[model samples]
Target: MRLVLRVGGLLIAICLVVACADATGVPGASGADVIFSDGFVPGQMGNWVIEGDNAGQTAVINEQLVFELADNNIMQFSTLPDVTFDNFILEVDAQLLEGDLGSSYGVLFRMQDSTRFYRFEITGDGLFMVERRDGESGWTRFVDRWTETPAIQQGLGSTNQLRVEALGTNISLYVNDELVHQFNDATYSSGTIALDAGTFVQPQAKVAFDNVVVRRP
Candidate 1:
């Protein structure tokens, strides 16, 4: 069953049951032809957005891209404004510095804009989800629910390697070098990418992302 709730001014959905697989491998597109990369060196975010306000803040500090959400039910994301990709292998290291265990952070791909994209998210408590957004229309869950997997490191201060490989309608998601889900969708074909973090109930979510690389698949 799926439950949708209105919390802190945003609509949130929860999936009650889902089935997924787990398998391990290297985290990145190590030897593939590189298309883009960012180590997030301090004060050097050429293609990424940096912003701060009452809702949240995003910045590059200490060699990492960080997101700090100030309120519950709010989501924050920073995108590579000029980079667009299709049929590529993208990977990054995301660590939850501090937040509620239910908070999620991950990659958004085929992002036509802020409100239109595909997201692969994992919570600090070891649950993962895949979903899509289509502007004011609504959100769609690719899986039945937020499924649990042993692949995530589970807890604050733990870094998880998040990877996504997209080829045509086939998209695969991985966490900490383990395959978590693979599915097919034709909603979007090509667009930009982003890193995002969102809060569920409690606020103050701080997540840092690093070593982002995208390669031709």
Candidate 2:
């Protein structure tokens, strides 16, 4: 995962435009205003930078952060620039606009860099996995393969709410407010959080993310 890089801009040091009061009792969360939201200001992409195929673009459409990809075997991520965190809860809503059922899109938090990070990915086909990258060590799945989960809303054009909590050696995964899986790994203690999209056996996956909230315990 560390050796892999492409074109995608990461939004760091930004604020979540709208606050989600509903996240009151999220895991590892306490009452706080730790949120980063982006509706892509008109004419301004804020602090985000793009990396990947020229056919892809990131913009604000209909008050949502949109990531449009191309028909290529590639992955793109949007994250913060110079900020990092550990032991926090990150939440976001992802909608698959156009893509195959096998395509994947989700959040990546505690990202040490373009090479190292923890990824909580869910496919449009209703599969989810917890994995991470360690520099040149390559990709290692904490949950192993992309496991199918009833917690996810399967199929394209479906929107799913994803959340992850990283505390100490314990990590918790949630889908649509349901606790689906939880495990522990002390490999990464701190890094930046990000939203990512990828193409698996298929090509050209488009996923939109919104209402990103990060709370620290």
Candidate 3:
């Protein structure tokens, strides 16, 4: 069930659910038309394009899309199919299988290419960040630094339901069925989406993802 929390005239939507792995395959939503999904049960990447410093580090392990990278400051991203939407909800299940809680992983959407895209990320240490990439020049943090929030479940081996919704120019971020932060910015309107995982200070960060579903919001 989704609840729209109106704050300062901006609509922030978060789907409230007790157990994230419950009934529907469509995140926490009920009766939503699933646009695209990948469970990794086939044990293959298929047409997904790999990008970043840890480009081909992602693989299908134990029926989940897992990215196990080496060293810090390395990010691995796997671009999916034609998942461009002006107003839609994108949700995926991710787990910190191995690494320090400071490591971060999430989704990248509204991408112009491999280098230009908007990223929404959540750390295992109860922190979140928003970033925009500018090709070889690198990324610029919209929030400047990592912002801590209790909405994210901390510690290793923890699972989180990461959600990013783009409704017009409004974007909301949610984790574990709770709204973390929201902002409005009209940048790229049409582009692809990708799964991203990276490390901060940890020597390595390993995360698993599955059941990615996109729907109309």
Using lDDT as the measure, the top candidate is: 1
lDDT of 3: 0.68
Best by TM-score: 1
For candidate 2, the per-residue lDDT at 94 reads: 87
| Higher-scoring candidate on TM-score, 2 or 3 | 2
Ordered by TM-score, highest first, the candidates read 1, 2, 3
RMSD of each: 8.1, 6.9, 10.3
The 10 consecutive residues of candidate 1 with the worst lDDT sum are 15-24
Tens digits of lDDT, candidate 1, 27-128: 452453877766765433344435667667777678787888878776666766566788999888999999899999998899887667898999999999
User: lDDT per prediction?
Assistant: 0.77, 0.67, 0.68
lDDT over C-alpha atoms for residue 54 of model 3? 32
Better of 1 and 3 by lDDT: 1
lDDT of 2 by residue, 1-217 (tens): 1123421221211111111122222233334447544444444334555444454566667756777777555666777756677777777788888878777778877777677888888888888877777766667777756688898888777779998888888989899998878878888888777777777556676788776667675
* Model 3 ranges with Cα > 4 A deviation: 1-32, 43-56, 136-140
* Candidate 3 clash pair list: none
Error of 3 at 127 (Å): 0.8
User: If scored against the real structure, what TM-score would every candidate get?
Assistant: 0.84, 0.80, 0.78
